[model samples]
Target: MTSSPVPDTPVEVIVDLLTKAQDIASYCDNMISDLFLAGQTLKMLIHMSQAKRVLEIGMFTGYGALSMAEALPEDGCLVACELEPYLKEFAQPIFDKSPHGKKINVKTGNAMETLKELATAGEQFDMVFIDADKNNYINYYKFIMDNNMLRLRGVICIDNSLFKARVYLNETTDSNGLALREFNQFVSNDPRVEQVIPLRDGLTLIRRVPPCKITDDEVFRGVTGRFILDRMRLDGKVAYVTGAGQGIGRAFAHALGEAGAKVAVVDLDGAKAETVVEELFLKGINAISITADISKSDDVQRMIDAIVSKWGVIHIGCNNAGINMNSASEDTSLEEWDKTFNVNLRGTFMCCQAAGRVMLKQGYGKIINTASMASLIVPHPQKQLSYNTSKAGVVKLTQTLGTEWADRGVRVNCISPGIVDTPLIHSESLRPLVQRWLSDIPAGRLAQVTDLQAAVVYLASDASDYMTGHNLVIEGGQSLW
Candidate 1:
């Protein structure tokens, strides 16, 4: 939802700074340590560690200094020490162009005297970078440790530790190479945690050893972890699905049974419900069938009683049975309006109340209602005032029961699905209506019954324990348009 941050300058200034630094190195009489990617590396380290106060012992062309400063917070500071005064003036022009230039304080003098001055000033740093003369590497590290100049969680980085691999191979008699070899040995035996990365010319990262270090046996003492996949499993649960004869209800029943719950398929058509139960049996799932019309209050109560008698408990109640009658607003009959509400909204409420009693007594249950995308947006090219209003009422009813039952160990939530490709919509008369709907759907297609399987399982599982009073809309971005 948020846009990428714009650069504080007119151009990609970091790349520009590196380009200018590389050009200056080519024309200069003195050699600058511009070979390694120290600028970007230090910048990444500063951002990761959130280092507010940085100490850069040697900043050649001010490229690394400016990079570190850029990563710092607005009020952060970086102290750049150097042995020569002329190099400060050479890099100052580039620094002045940067917004972070104010964060850098260039100290021109002998490096050791500047370190002593900072120590006496009662200063501490979150990060310390040492890339100066190799001969004084040990002395700089020693001063930092002995004076307590580094914070307890501070990081100290040493560049060029391998010294062109000469320290490890011992192939050179050069003074800088020999000094680096000794410094590497000293750090290897020190009481700290360190890692040497072969990033260009050996970058060594060191941090203070943590006290009370973690042990293998203590990793999971008196505790266990069930990861996301395990938490999603609905093992040892009992579930019953209304209108499980076919379509979305059939899918929800099969999904719940496949997830290790004993399932009962309820429907007004006894033969169709038995057929679906037979399909579940072929898949080695334990299931039963019950005939009941949810629109009747007695039938709804009988449906819940039948499930509890078979499984001894009901853990999941899926109220997915509903009907829609398409008609013009003015031409819609009172019979059609009442019929839609009786089955869609009133039946759903009856099922919720009956199942909610058993769940409240047992201290746990999940009820999932099947609402429609029509509850959110008016379906174009067709008018079904009663159907749309009933579905909207379903959503409101779900929110009310969800909040009321949440504290009593019963969770209620609704799913609003887009137009689905089913046998009911596979007619010649509805072909033009389907085409008009596809244009409104951003995905350019209708949702399949299988497409909504995971959503039902998520609501029925322990994974959605923290969620309540929610309307989960799965409309393929149709409602947005």
Candidate 2:
């Protein structure tokens, strides 16, 4: 499929061995094309995906297996299946000679039986490469799907799908070519996956959609599709954001809405929340407003209940409500400290707890808490002991919750942002403090609300499923100082 010439550089140990295997194939009059380009492509994909476990349906002289194994991390592994015992015998010694050879598990016999055994053992793979018998391609796909051999969001790459370009001959009687055409059509018609044919011989890449049981209509009829970027789009997802009347919270609400989420904008000021909802509706985004005092458990529950009643589920929760107070530590009153803690720390906990209850039942959710640069470093020319401590508590809360809920499929992460050019920091009274922050910040400018948009989307989407207990810092190098 790939006509590009192989690089003229000296071959690696595995490549050299594969070259020798090619000579063997010629002597035996066996039909085998050097899969050097495909092997290289697989290596790049393995590295990009950080894939640890791979399943290969065919292994000829261990070229493809070795390529993927070499790209994998030290603890990574590849299960290579070859139907013929002779091929396995021929490839085993070559695999044993390479540094990554030990990573390859040469399994001889029928690949279908091997897949069934792996499935029965509850084994899952980050990627599955199918390049064995042509007649069984459709059966292999069905087996993989029915048995859940691939993990949710895992990839399946099928090689030689074009069958030497004979699949296009309408009147041809080639059995292998006809079988490939049927397999390609079957995969193309599958609604549960989004696929692409990247190479000439039809290197088809298929990605299983989210395991949350999203319907084909929901995936295909909406803005979401098989495109990698589209996977980040949160179509049909319901999102809730606190303090959405203005500033960073407002920006988060808008960003999530733009990404196809139905948003609930919660604010203490009922009028302000409704105003923001109206603005969202003007942009054709599905949104609602809920007035709640986030510090109060009753208010928080009511808000969550209202959102669930309207949308049936909560997929994203942004606990962004908090009050800031600036006073010298010695002069900071107990009332100020308690109030800050109640709103910033206690409010965040209440939101996470309420959301966690629903998400734990659903087995999936993303929680984004708004922390601050104060959580990591003391700000210059500003005395806000209570505020700094409250934000620090937020970071700890996020990490603790993230660890506890990770296995439950709910992720809790916090964003620590530097001084932003928002109303909170750009006031006349805070002009001197803002200038001091700029001097310490290497970026020489305060972050805009838009700067944090992509980070919020990343943590809120399925893209960050494996990431939890992490505090994403968007401080423009201020904390580095």
Candidate 3:
């Protein structure tokens, strides 16, 4: 078991308030953030992240607010969200007594309203601490991500994540426990990366998966002229994603379908592929699902034939399905190496070759492959010698085909992403290593699957007709260091 934490700064304010509030008939300690739990961690996290602005969803007793304020830089700001106005009065004298009190601003009333107001004003935060009503935990997290209120390198800490251990236990009628359980599961499936520290009530730290500034606002600025815009539209194109069942591949399937292409969602799992087809149908996009293993040449050929027969032509091919297995160089077995290579390199080759034949006959096609940052740079701290080497081979394969096919009206390209926050790293074994990886990244975040949507669209559309034999890397500059 971990030892209880001691604050780096003296919390004389907490001592004073507890001593005085004991006699107040309206006082309650249940909502207070104790130093033994989330209190001290918030201070250390702020200091480590060098956060300039912090948000506390519930500021009872001003202990959490004061502790975090003490950790902020001299110019830093801390916005406290509180529902009860009387607590501010009780905590005001204690706040006035501390030197860091000037940095704290307490906003009283409904927190949901405060959040909406902040959204309207275009506010963002480096750190957000939530210790509010349990029922609203999931709602708060969703709002923060949807509104872009969290900075690229920012983190959100949720207190009482374990909810007295009911979150992991059998079903409970306790509304608080049930809500926390739902919140934990929801975050697990989210695009962001998170880690839960078993600090008494459990503190979960979450951060965005990707870093990029090219949003709709930039597109809305009319950077693309109407004259050349037609080249970017995929109105009559036919596309297919090899791993269209879920995660990044699923996202690419949706993106290409939405871009006006008839998509064939291909995956090893027939049910998953069919589900994606249903999603496309809901969006009024003509689509189909093909179950095939890219490693098998027959399967790959059949998958391609089905698409060509349905659409009468294949204009775009997204070879996005791949796998990774980590093992020490000396310990990597031949079976492990072959499995990694079979999918990452050989499987991609078969898909490219089969799709190239159809495109070569038609005299036109765009092939987008999925590569990894590991292909270019060794992402250390986790040993995956085979996985890294296989991806490097994929880059070479893409360049080989791209140059050969360029003169034949077939453009081949690959997209290399930084360590994406996918289900691959959600295992308990990889959690600690993910934390180390985050610290080394300059952008301080992983790439969300959504971050790569537009990249695939560009490579598939005529906008990149002249660009071939290129590796479009969307990694958040993690390989630079």
Candidate 4:
């Protein structure tokens, strides 16, 4: 059995320290060390008694620094490097209030250069916390070790070593994922480090071994627009999308067309419909474009007809269009209220009704609706009464239709996106509110378009055949609040 935690420190002391650490880390000005975990403080402290001098490389709000500083003896000292002056200024008071404040020194500037300077000054540490720079994690570790910043028995803690657990998978493509994968392998084989912790994102705890170095062998390296189209076949299949003239809609149309489904690109602008169709024809996706207000029936009907006349069937329908007014109930206008629902809600229902009929006959089809986390929770700093209400309606609609069409083979589902970095979001209405709502997002930023692709692919593929009427909330746990 594994040995128990040290009995010298009271559990309550650890809990209080961690609580303060979390509060300080959560400060808005410091996004650098935003990935630090409070729980890791307890483990880090257990290994900290051996060190009289501790250095924390990334001191975002001073959470990691504070936690490690508190564990140091009266003669022990901590040097924390924070690049942002505002963050340093903001966090200084928090540290000043701490009992170990006198023992901690806050340094400001580029962490790589600062750490190098400290090494040049013969500054060594018994413990170090490396929690910055995803793209430079491997390089940073090498620099810290090459300069002998850590004594042979010194302990080093690296946070975000997992990069959202993406590195463990095979399909990782982003820089963060690639860098983490490389770092993990480097640490795993580096004779200098004994163990690594695969915590939340990831954390590695390594004890310095003299004459050992992190080698290069471990060094690893790692848009839309809308438009028109025409359906080629429907024999018994149907497909539809909102905002189809540009961005993700155009991408989805090409994908579905290549698969042989008669696809419809639904857009508010008629000209966009024609343009999208032309692009699809060039790619051979059997696609067409229809200009219709998603919220209005007559408009949707014209587009629906284009698909029916060409393919004689409807199978896949996508509710992918939405708008944001960015107004609270008091500030929101009746026009904004009606307009948002008209497109996201009324339009979704109109398309569902038209496609539901065809699917009821065929007894097999798929309907994918796009919902938003604004529907599930009240997002802060950025308020959009109309947008939130409309998306909420889409969720209930999906569930209701899913129940009605389950036996009919028509799977109805919704993809609830968090704040996606889309053109619409970048529109005049949303840009002002981005920075306000960003801090609330668990993922630390707006959702990327690529982030939504997999969720859509999953819902559209046969892999989700057995799944129906499910509201797939993909907002990066924003609703967890």
Candidate 4 stretches with Cα past 4 Å from truth are 1-237, 258-260
User: Which structure among the candidates has the greatest lDDT?
Assistant: 2
Candidate numbers sorted by TM-score from highest down: 2, 1, 3, 4
Query: Is 1 or 4 the stronger prediction by TM-score?
Result: 1
Residue 169 shift from truth in candidate 2, angstroms: 26
What is candidate 4's lDDT per residue for 1-481, written digit by digit as tens? 2233543333233344444555666552233233234535633564444578988777776655666666678888988888888878866776676777677898899888888889889999887778777887888788877787778667877877877778877987888889889988887888766765676557677886544333423221100111111122232345777787876666666656665566788888879978988887887666777777877788777777777787777778887877667776898988999988888898888888887887788887788888878778978776778888898999999999998888978899998888777677677766788887776777778877667665665566555678888988877777885
- TM for every model, in the order presented, reads 0.55, 0.55, 0.54, 0.49
lDDT of 2 by residue, 182-299 (tens): 9989988888788986475678889987544446664544444455467688899999999999999999999999998999999999899999999999998999999999999999
| lDDT-better candidate, 2 vs 4 | 2
Once superposed on the true structure, which residue ranges of model 3 sit more than 4 Å away at CA? 1-229
Model 1 lDDT tens row, 135-210: 9999998898778888866888998888888887656888888998888788877775454564667778877544
Question: Which pairs in model 1 have colliding backbones?
Answer: none
Q: Rate the local accuracy (lDDT) of all candidates.
A: 0.85, 0.88, 0.86, 0.73
